[model samples]
Target: MSGTLALASAIAEMDRDALESLVRRRRPQAPAGVLDPIGLAAELLRPDSILRALSPLDRDALAVLLGLAEEPRAGLARDTDTRTAERVSALLALGLLGVEDARPVALPEVTNALRHALMTAGHRPDDLSTPPPSRSGDNASAPPAAPPSADSWVTAALTAVGQTAECLRVLRDRPARLNRSGSVAVASVRGMAESIGIEADHAAQALAAADRAGLVASGGSSLVVSERAEEWTESDHIARWLDLAATTLATIPAPLRAGLVREEPLAAIAAGLPERFPLLSEAESTAARRFVVAAEYLGLSSHGRLSSVAELLHSGERAAAERLVRDLLPPAAPGVYVQPDLSVIVPGPLAPADEIDLAALTVPEHIGVASTRRVTEASIAEAFSRGITPHQARAAFARVSLTGIPQPLDYLIGSLAERVGNIQVSEHHGDDGRTRIVVGSSELADTLTVDRALQHLQLHRVDPTTLCSRLRADHVLAALADARYHASSPRARASAKAATESTAPPRAQDAHDDLPEALSDLVERVFLAARSEPGTSNFTRRLELAIRDRVPVRVTAEARGQQHTFLLLPVSLSGGRLRATDQAAGVERTLPVNLITAVESA
Candidate 1:
């Protein structure tokens, strides 16, 4: 009862618009009659509502709030800095702190519920220290970092962009299955790492980030590259990297995000989380650690400091962030040098389309500021198996080559084109439904039959120039292509394309899509209900509430043509009369409810 009275008193001090705004921000639906001061106060004091209000608070604000709650009688110290003043003002606006006798004070019920919840969730009071100043505002500027070269980070960032593209390609080709927990299976993760030429941990982080960026999504039973992934891949390097950084800042858990946007040290975010959020679950702790490594690996941060681009993005200044990061990126190479040694050297980052085209024909040797790739017989054969014609391959290289194609490379392409399609894959006519592979010569047939990579097909040698397998024709052709045998079939290319496209998953519907409208409706209902009712009806309703709880109220009434005031315990209300015992004179009294002019809790 005292908690209700105290909270009601606080709510009464707020203007109607201010009260309605606070009610709307809390995540609960306002029931009918919530416009009453006591009714709204009770709802805001609920434990769930308190927790919802606490979520967006930074560390310093939370520290100040908890300090007020823990030592309510001691009162807060005078605000000496802009940061402290801002925090106190925020708390006051949230209604967590109310002005009482010109000093900030907390509601006992709200504070008690919050402290109990924290304690029950394993938060120890002694373990909580005065939280460090949040890096969210002017304090977000970090100390200057020691460096290698000025452009080293640009090289690092460019390489990460390329790696991300490679990772997306891997997922598109072979969608990974989900485990029981709905995360990518560990074996699939290992395979992805091996395919992308990175360690398993780094690959996992890349996958996590890609999922957050909407480049990857869940298929029915597995994870697949999203439909938007191709467009993202083909976008400019600056847009691609900025998308990753912005998505990461937007979707990561609040604790780690606070560290990032606040410019706190990444390494300390996880360790320092208990001081922010009470305690960290195992899953939260792992995610925080992984995020720390991934942020740096993605070039969004360096050492322990956040990059200026990330800071700008977190502040909702997308254009400024893009400009800052663009200034730091190295220029893209217009063309590559095609040397006679069958090696291509890229002096800088290539445009996305050119990079994709070159990757399709040449094997990457190194990928960095200056990349090196080689054109080999097997590489050309694989490209041919994927349905790239010799003429098309020549045109691709010529288009991106700064120098004319060297004669050695030209001769090699022609010879390799002639060798391709020397083997053909077709369906067998037998009812058993098998595939047949035929070679141009007995020597070629003998080599294909004994090849270790082709052994998985269980190819049975029927003659010097022929072999058969129980697998489908497309499967056999793909295996042969992967083995660099340059086998061709009409259905192979379509099947590969279908396999890639079929893995694109449907977009999941957001569960909270209608939350904003629901909150808006609740606010409107409360405001309308308050406005439509008369003051007499409100006074009568307050008397009914006080009578139901047997609480003392200050009641003013007109009785026998004279105004009288009484401190009374409201006992009952019926027959349009309020029955009560006057507390000051210790006497029973009854007043016509319609004649009661005012009723407020004493």
Candidate 2:
């Protein structure tokens, strides 16, 4: 049995006094292969490992771990007797902590394990949220809260959150996909980040917050809006944002997590923070910076501390909840400015709904007084595809800009709308469970006859009005677009488009309904692509992948009857084994697969 199991057996039945006698007999450090602090964590969290090492601690023993979980980077070293020291030191045997500068530092797993242990012991996690009094200078009696509803920024902030949640609902329902290893595809990440006004790295954190708030959840390869998300919409707007703020705050590690509503600038934490989070990396403290900014934007925070309104709402102060929304958000600019450069200038932050509506038509580029945003043919065409007609879209902008729409944008929007569906594509159901394209347009027929795209389809033009193709709708449409013709699908549903810029917006109650699961499934062939490939690569293939991905790989080799695993970035294949630089040890080593028990990307 492992040394950790042995330790667990030794202390399983021992009381305080019995523990002293047992400890007096022997006290051993963690066995070999457990010394490196990060290595230990990697082993525990690796997909292949079960993490049963921490299964032995009792309620009191778990309480100690819970303490460490609060602030892992700043672990406590309390004075202890021989027996107590032995008890605590036993954790070292499990590779749970490491000494740095002669001090034992806890890893992030402590936090996760502590949560599980706390729940196992029938205790709420809040029991461990109270940190050592000496560590937090803030008052322990009450945590920081947001400003009163009387404040202007408070209401606007909640509106922003409301709009953001709605937009996320749309994106989630469409169900964007992720790559293997759970990283958002670069393009997908960029698009989602832009829509939400956050950095790409923080996009994951924001999505996580939504998940915790029950707004979204993992749905196979993509994230989906949860059924609870409808419940969120039914609740009070400010209350929804307030709940998210508190939950997101809980995600921040202590001593910072205890009270996020503090008035001090967290620039120091953003600059030198060293706590390792499972998702957010330590680059300019992107997660912390984004979290603070999102909170402030949502009015959950004011100045540097929690707003009074946030605290009041959270504390169930419903007395003025109705009137609190007037000044809740930073009031939007009185009016936008229309420019001759095909741009509309916004003087202040737009309401989240207004932002989405405007974003559907124009590309925002500036943020100052009369912030500049351009309206181009491409943007207008995109807006058209989403259900906004050129005239209606221009009218909506004109209403926002007191100065009225400029001649340039008016002409641009018209040109884009006219060009959007010049070539229309539709599918005709066929026998043998396959489908064909029914491409049509008076303007596109001449070009379609001579185009290389239609050459492959062998289109038989029965009339000037239309032509049928054996090629599938997607292929025909893509080909027409590649030939510089604007192709559109009659199948496009613009139901979610806002009524302000569209004639056929769905009713408010029906806006988020009727999502078809297999919208793009009509074709002759349906090849199911795997999200991840099976592990069948040889040494050469693995080395190529290591080079391509540039991530650490776990290499296991046996020595002295114990299997040792090392994290390595493969540099080259050499000497009948892979030559790599050990990321943890910062040294080069060669790993051979013959005696190596396992090798996989970490």
Candidate 3:
């Protein structure tokens, strides 16, 4: 029967409840006999060929065994036929069955043995109905001793390796004891033989040969592996198999080989390696490349050059194109430049200075003027040409005036002129007592340093009230104020504003209202020191000192059968009864709020 169909048939015959009961009842001291007939039958139904091979039985027999319930001898005889009854009796005689509550019970060890037997049976060929022709001589008394074939040994060894490989993978991380079972090792060997369509005895002999070659270790029930074998298993065993197939394909003539080569890049590489290398065949080189690519993609080795090569290979190049692209891109930097007219300038490696100058000179100038307007305008234009905004220029002007020029007007003009890359000086006569100044900008002198000019005039005893009243009367200040007021009102409402502005520390009396700065600082220091101390005892002592000196003194008093502590601040202590306030509720109560075991200004 086909393996799939046989598996389906076995599954159809399984009784899940009976199988579970069987598994639960059979408690083998060892790992091998964990499953009884029912459990074995269930395993047979699994899609795994190894498991299916482990249980060999007709679907009907499997169904019958899986349906059997745990019962006493009487119940067993009652439920089963004479043949099954005899088998059960024989099993009991063999000490494989136990009596519990006067019931016939299958021991876990026996069940496990039976499971292994069934599994081996399933793996054995169904065509074994016909025996091999007798090799015995014509002598009637001749013994039936026969020698094993070489093919049998080879098949068996391969099976043993395959099965042991699987078990090793499963048990690699588990404790060694879990894999110490001789039966498990034996089962693995049998499974390997089954996988390769061979007999266990031959596979066992082949395993012996491999053991002699130092590829595998056969010690008692366990298998040991040599370093070479360990390395092979850890590395590219799967890729090796693919390479083997590719090598076989490469033996064919070129025209036929081309078809196989087209299946995958590895195959193509394998086919081309011979022409590509003097010592290696095309298939060998392809196999090597395939292995490397697979390893790199799997993240097996960080140093593998496949990623770099793959990029090049994909792009029809011989080197990494992506890395080249990354190298070709320009590096990024912070801090952009701004033109003098308040326009931002994006930094590029190369910028045309002449083009910027032309743009600056062509832009239309603004109207309106002040006493320092000309100097300010020229500074603004110069700053723009130099790729800096008016605001930055103004800040530079302020810094220079603060440090260099004592005469405010001249200082402001000089600073503005410096920002614009201009050094020209202008003398201006204004209404304020023959003021002679070096103006930087003919148009921007007022805009750049108007505030500085007003401050300078005021310092020089200029009558600001009469000048400001005259300007107010002329409607200049009113027009400016109205424009600012209109601009302040926006279409969108702003996010909620803060309730209070940040301020300096309050005095000692205001400490009760809010924690004083000195106390807050002490509290922070004390908390940190307490946390850093070795133990809780040290922490309490430090905390006590900080509280006593910085916080109000509180006396502990028992009231209403509860201990109450109150902080006796001077303001609150005047009254006999303590009135505690709740900050969250914004209410004051007669209850002692300051009566705290832990006392420190918050």
Candidate No. with top lDDT: 1
Q: What are the per-residue Cα lDDT tens digits for candidate 3 across 1-602?
A: 11222221222223443223222332122323212222232233333422222122233222223223223344466446775666444333323344333445544333344345444534222222233233323343655333222122222222233333333322221211214443335666666555433456544543433333334433333454434333434433222222222222223332222222212333333444332222232454454554443332222212322233233333345234334423432222132333343323323211122212222322212110100112234334444433454455445433322133224434443444443323122122455433322223443333323444234332132222112212211132233223221101111111101101111212112112433344334334323432332222311332232332333334345666687544433123112234444343455545332232333333
The global C-alpha lDDT for each of the candidates, from Candidate 1 onward, is 0.71, 0.51, 0.32
Encode model 1's per-residue lDDT on 39-82: one tens digit a residue.
66566767777766765555466566667767765436646567
TM-scores for the candidates: 0.71, 0.46, 0.14
Most accurate candidate by TM-score: 1
Provide the global lDDT of candidate 3 against the true structure: 0.32
Write down the worst ten-residue block by lDDT for model 3: 491-500
**Which tens-of-lDDT digit does each residue in 258-281 have in candidate 2?**
234344444333433322211122
In Å, residue 46's CA in model 2 sits off its true spot by: 25
Q: How close is candidate 2 to the true structure, as a TM-score?
A: 0.46
Q: For candidate 2, what is the lDDT?
A: 0.51
Answer with 1 or 2, whichever has the higher lDDT.
1
Question: How many angstroms is residue 379 displaced in model 2 relative to the true structure, after the best TM-score fit?
Answer: 2.2
